[model samples]
Target chain A: MKLLESVGRIVAISRKEIRQLRRDRLTFGMVVAIPIVQLVLFGYAINEDVRHLRAAAVDYANTQNSRLLLADAHASQVIDLVRKASSAEELEEWLRRGEIRVGIVIPADYERRLEDRKRHGRSARPLAQILVDASDPATYGSVAGLLNLPPPERPGIQPPRWRYGSAISGVSNPPPTFEARPFYNPERRSAVHIVPGLVGVILTMTMVLFTSVAIVRERERGSLELLITTPMKPVELMVGKILPYVLIGLIQVGLVLGVGALIFRVPLRATPQDTIVAALVFITASLTLGLLISTIAKTQFQAFQLTFFSFLPQMLLSGFMFPFDAMPRPAQWIAELMPLTHFLRVIRGILLRGARVVEMRHEIWPLAVFALVMLTLAAGRFRKRLD
Target chain B: MSESAEQVIRSQGLTRRFGSLVAVDHVDLEVPKASVYGFLGPNGSGKTTTIRMLCGLLEPSEGKAQVLGLEVPKEAEGLRRRVGYMTQRFSLFEDLSVFENLDFLGEIHSLKASHRRSRIDTLLERYRLADRRKQRAGTLSGGQKQRLALAAAVLHEPELLFLDEPTSAVDPENRRDFWESIFQLADEGTTVLCSTHYMEEAERCHLLAILDHGKLVANGTPQQLMDDVDATVVEIQTEDPRRVREQLAGMTGLLSLAQLGNRLRLLLHREVENPVWQVEEELDIDAGATVQVVRPNLEDVFVVVTRDEVS
Candidate 1:
């Protein structure tokens, strides 16, 4: 009888929630609109198979070998040879102005350096340096991967040591050509990597944003006074309010995954059951996060600002934009605490690597724990008292 | 708080403080069952705060309350189903149709669908909203929205109802219509506690409590409060009412003064015998002004209690 009563009240609140959502045309529109817009924007915007980096060359060597190096750099279609700086200082000035990303500075004695390397089986320094702006670390990695192309057809001459250099972005020295093998996504289609990650990102943005504002919106509208005075328990209210959103989250998952496969041709390698379980776990975690925000925020606008601020760290550090392993230990530790970080792992595992939900326990358990912790905190913060 | 079968709401030394500011201070109340008890005070007089405490929407910083025979803020869950609250604003979902709003409330109360339908029908007819059952509450006019809010509050058949400034935004005609429904509910043996700043609305209640700056200064029936008021009423008619008002503005024992057209109505301490003569002496008019003692109204009661700060 007690279980029946709880069910009845939860169902009632869910029904009311759906009715209100239906009446709000703009919010209803957003449930479908957010995913598609995020897909298109994120698909092309964060594409990491970067090409045509605007480049300037400083040829201190001014020799045939230097010209051959410049031609190869341009012909590689990795960096656009846009300008020829008369000096390295001018090249650095161009980089500072943000006009160029890759500055190929061939040292003054490029041929002699190669000859010296062959003669002594060692060189004093690298033959030349490719100065890249590492301000956005995600994009600059592709510039280092330019060595994937065949070196500029130098006959019997050993490969030139074109060292990857950094400028103006805070990194004194960045690693060279990280993760260029392209295992799961063999076509190296950025869509393959991004679509899976987009599932977590878009869900996090919509789910948390919508649920976080739920309670605060009711309080602002004064309906919360009536709601709390009802026999509705805090747990019942929380469960009921999230039901419709959970369903919406499911629809969004289907829409995003379906469109991703159909339009982007990004294959879904996970079994149906694995996909459902992982998505549901992630959806709950994200919704719980939103509820937590909703309880903490005093106004709808404040909730929105908080949601946007919350998205920033997750987007930058969650391995959705940058490589997870590449981030420093402190950043990785902070990312470990976010449910999105684990969710990105689980989703990418299921969607790209064909891992079962249970096999992804390393990632899934944290999300389940996250949902529990967030639900507890949100319920605790949602006191029945108005003040 | 003393427990009595006749009292539906009882509170002793009720207080609420917001940070360093005391919003409600040491209010003691006994609300008899099935009575239309009113709280009459100006804005920020702790009227809403007291109602919130009783309804379990706010916790009292001090004191105890027993509402619907349950200890409030402790057994507030028990009190919730037994009581109903209609906030000062129209708190029902504006995007919902009238029927949907009531249906949602009925479902939340765990009412059976058949019974929920019948209760909603009766309320729709009683509140004159039968034709508006399909209209979204946000689209309703001021009067219609007020009726819908009242109907939603009562649909679960609560034993007690609390209305916080329910009619502040309504016109006089709609306010009268709204009160008719309140009386009907009271006749059905449901207790009601209402707060209002309007004098006429306060006068219509069976009993009234006047709160000034979080303190209850008076409690009794309207007639009893007037009969037992500490001040006496005096009215003066003159050619230059402003001049008379200025002359008597700072008179000792002068509780309140108002110009009703060409007449300056005043309240003074009952100890001021022959107040008409005192006011006339202040005006110093031979035949330009006429003054006399008068009966006290609810507004006079309000002025006597709250305007003490000015003196």
Candidate 2:
């Protein structure tokens, strides 16, 4: 009988909150519209695997071998040969002016070396050099690797091979070959990586901002007095006040995830149950944090300031826009304290790595513990008395 | 009502202090059932503070209070369902419609669905809000909002109702209508403890307590308070009442002087000997001027009680 009464009061409060939310058309629109707009805007704009970098080729060889090598580099699609330079100095000027990411130079004796190696077949070596702008790591890293791919196989041309001796003599020589094959996102689509992390960021922004003003608005408007005078307990009021916003948070998640899958073609690799559980835990943590903020704030304006104060730190330290491991040691420790850091890991792990729940224990348990701690603290901070 | 029944609310030296400021001092009250008890005071006189303590919305810094026979601060949760509180401000959910507001209150009070619906309908009709049931409380006029707040407060038919300055925003006509509704509830054996700064409203209550700077200076029936006033009231009608007021301003043994058109009402200290003669002598009586002693009203009692505390 006692439990039923508590349920009844919670339902009553939740019903009132839902009505209030409906009446506030702008807030309701923000919940659904902001996530979709942010998802589409951020998902399509960020690119990690930069391609089609401009290049200047100074081919002093003027030979078919140099032309065929340049054509092979061009066909790889990593660099676009925009201009031909007469000297290495001119190529260096183009690279300095940011006109091109790579520059290739061939000596005038390049064909003589190949022909001599073909004849002597023993001691001759071919020398070809490439100049590259190593400034932007993301842009230069991929382009430089593509520029160094194994020389194309030519008809009547034998590629160099190192001679190996018998094992009994303890002498061995092997050819040097470097190859890189990226997994998970073989194409390196930025949206596939960014969209999963966006689920956490969007949920944190909306859930914390929306729930932070719930109780403080009531207190400012005097409805809190009416609520306290009723048979509603503090815990019941807190739960009921946040339950409607939790549903709104779920709707936001669905909208963002649906848009992510349909528009960005980001895979949903995790099981539905795992995704739902992670989302629930994250949303609960955010809402409880907001409730705690409301209890500390005396007005709606203070609540807003407090929400933004926490929001900025979460956005910077949660590994959504920057890599967590790249930050300094102190910053990484601070990031560890943020629930969004763990939530981002769970979401990205599930969506990108196809991580099962058993494999995501580290992320899931911390998120659950964060939600539990925040809920207990919020309940403790919310007092029944007006004073 | 039986004479041996317990008082609906009883307090002994109930006090609340905020740092160095005392918002509600040692106030002892015994409010019996089925009576309209009015708390009259000026702004910041702790009327709202006392009401909050009674409603279990605040904790007193010192002393004890038993509301509806339950020890406050200890049994406040049990006392919640039995009491209804209407704050000085319009505290209803403004975004909700009239019917929705009342329905929410009924549900929070744990009323069954069938009972909630019927009670809400009756309240809407009684409060003359049936036509505006679909209107948002925020969009309602001041008088309409007050009626809606009252309807929400009484939706559960609580045994005790605390209205803190309930009609401060309404006009006189609406205030009269509101008092009529309050009286109707009292007639149905509900105990009412309301706070107001209006003297006429206090005059209508069965019992009145006057607070000044967190102290309960006076408590009694309106008639008893008037009879027990420590000053005598004298009305003087003259061709120029302002001149009479000016002349009486610096006079000794004078408590307060108020002018109503061409008549001047003076409250003199009780130790004065023949105030009419004293006033006439001081103002230089003329043949056309008339002076006579009259019965004291609640305002005179208020001025006399609070005037000394101000100094």
How much TM-score does chain B earn in each model? 0.96, 0.96
Error of 2 at B158 (Å): 0.8
Task: Pick the DockQ winner.
Answer: 2
Candidate 1 is graded, for docking, as medium
Give the alpha-carbon lDDT of every model. Answer: 0.83, 0.82
DockQ for model 1?
A: 0.62
State the lDDT of candidate 1 residue by residue for A257-276, as single tens digits: 99999988988888888888
DockQ of each: 0.62, 0.74
Worst 10 residues of 1 chain B by lDDT: B278-287
Off by over 4 Å in 2: A44-177, B1-4, B286-288
Q: What TM-scores do the predictions have?
A: 0.81, 0.82
TM-score, chain A, candidate 1:
0.67
Residue B128 of model 1 has an lDDT of: 92
Give Cα distance to truth, residue A144, candidate 2, Å.
Answer: 8.2
Residues A1-387, candidate 2, lDDT per residue (tens digit)? 889989998999999999999989999899888898888777754324545667778988877777877887788767778899999888865554444557877778877765554444434444466665443334445664663454443554544343212221231222111123233455556787778878898998888888889889999999998989999888888889899988998888888888888998887877888888888889999998899898899999999999989888888888677655345669878988899998987777667656666566777788778888888888888889988
